[model samples]
Target: MNGRGVITQICIIGAGPAGLLLGHLLRAEGIDCVVLERHTPDYVLGRIRAGVLERVTVDLMERLGLDARLKAEGLVHDGFNLTDGERLIRIDIAGLTGQHVTVYGQTELTRDLMDARHGRGLEVVYEAADVALHDIESDAPFVTYLKDGVQHRVDARIIVGCDGFHGPSRKAIPVSVGKEYEREYPFGWLGILADVPPCNHELIYANHARGFALASQRSETRSRYYIDVPLTERVEDWPDERIWDELAIRLGPQAAAHITRGPSIEKSIAPLRSYVFAPMRHGSLLLCGDAAHIVPPTGAKGLNLAASDVHYAAEALTAFFRRGDNDAIPAYSDRALARVWKAERFSWSLTRLMHRFPEDGPFERAMQVAELDYIASSRAAQTSIAENYVGLPV
Candidate 1:
């Protein structure tokens, strides 16, 4: 569309949910853009799993005409259970605040988005595409990438780095203005997917002296579960019997026996951590989603936070592209950081409440239990959790 042979006005890197959803939104607005992904569509669609989504995200998908697939397949969780060895306390999210979380994996969301993008006849380059970004201060920021063993360069009015934490977009920003804050927890989550029905009707967050265990469902016949373990532990070290024994101990005596384990479709240790980079922008290049920040999965804010960030970026970019106003660009960091900090606080609080800290004494453990009890008993506290868990309004 330009003299430089750039086919689109914007080029988006990474076809993850954030990138794909942003592409969908921009396409609906008749904006021209292309998406580049590092993994094949099948791999991207099969590997990632994110079980929590806020009401705002679901509403946005519905408004954007992207909810049909989600509605037909997604599981709506109206409540969550908190257990401390013997007693089980359930917090009804919908009853508390008229909001609920939808159990949809990030991979599934990516699949749906890719389907939508393909249906619209949009282009998405996948598998080992190398992207080189240039001209952050100029009106036209060119993206050079390789496709099919051939080098290609495309010039665009703007470039969006929706790639995740491991992608190259974040490194493109000059290190002088960017400061990354990170913390790696001593523990990681051993996530597993089984073909059995859920052990509980709702999500169960069980805290025991052994560790933290989460029992959640993906579908009627499939369940998703997690157990906290040392960061250095390997999946191979956790045999089937060991995995089940840990789950049973943490889930307490009420868990159904003989719950079948599927082919261990997914197994990995997700290292817990919190990361944030200030100013999220340098000149015209902007970062969103995991490219900007990362949070421990304890609060289930990773995917939703990414969606919120991109939504804000879309709004800002729309204003600039249409009216030539630079106000939004300058305020991008502050605007996004506000929501980022709130998520950070919630994530850390949840992590603290559930996990056993190395330095935590009896008093701290008692305080954690008391906090959990307070949340379960107090309507005000439950409402606060519901509002955040179901997602805050964008």
Candidate 2:
């Protein structure tokens, strides 16, 4: 195949939530763009991801004109549980924050974005191989990528690295221009998705002597559950029955009684980490989502954070193109980082407050109990937790 280069205003790498949403939003604003993904469409759809949507995420989807299916199919969760074996504390999101989170799988949301893109005949190059960035420091930046063993190029006014942690975009930014901050936990969450109905109406996060366990769901009948495991643990080591048994012990008797065990459709171990790359822009190339930061799953902030990044990027890029405004570009990085750090703090605080750290001693464990006790009894603490859970702002 012979290649003739394509040119556009914005060339986005990685068709994940951030890239696709930004692409769709830019199109709605009459900005020209294209998206590239290293994975095939089916592979992207099959990936299992969390679904607790902050009110802002829901609003963004509605603005994209993709909320019809989400509204009809998603579950509205007014509250979630935080437990310490002997007791459970439910933070009423609606009562305290005047907002309710919606439970809709990330897979479903991505599918909606994909469908919207296709309906508008937007281009997304799938299975892009060996993608690379060029001349990001100059006004004219471009992308070179391989597709079906053939080389192709996209020259654009701006390039976005919505690509992920391991993607080339951040690496393309010289280390001198950016600083990276990261923390890797000693344990990982071993999660599973099963077809059985969820045990409760809302998600449950339990802290026990053994470890942390969570009961979450994708839909009314499709359940998701996870248990914290040492870094040495493997999915092969956790048979279905063993996982169910451990979940019961950690969640204690009351929540365990409602458990419905079934064969898992998907299972994996995800290591926890908190990471942020500062100054998310390097000239014409900017980073978003995992390409810029990562939060532990404890606060369910990963996907929501990605959506917010897209929100900021879409607005900034639109203004830049429409009015020749240069301010929103640099401002986007600073503004997004402020919120990213707050989310990092929330995830870090929650992880420490709930999980049984390998190095935690008696006093550390007591701190967990004390904090949970206070949160359970104090309305102020509950409100604080509820506001963060529902998201702070844009």
Task: Output the TM-score of candidate 1.
Answer: 0.94
Overall lDDT per candidate, in order of appearance:
0.82, 0.92
Candidate 1 yields a Cα-based lDDT of 0.82
Worst 10 residues of 1 by lDDT: 1-10
Tens digit per residue, CA lDDT, model 2, 1-394: 6477999999999998888888888988889998999999999888898799988788889998899999999999999999898797899999998889999999999999998887866789999999999999999999999988789999999999999899999999998989989999999999989999998899999999889999999988999999999999989999999999999999889889999999999999999999999999989988999999999999999999998998989989999999899898878899899899999999999999989998889999888888988998899999999999989898
Q: What tens-digit string does per-residue lDDT give for candidate 1 at 68-179?
A: 9799989888988878887888878989887789988777777778877777766788874777888977877888877677777777777889898988888988888799
List the candidate 1 regions with Cα displacement exceeding 4 Å. Answer: 1-7, 256-263
TM-score of each: 0.94, 0.99
Identify the leading candidate in terms of lDDT: 2
**Top TM-score hit:** 2
Candidate 2: worst-modelled 10 consecutive residues by lDDT: 114-123
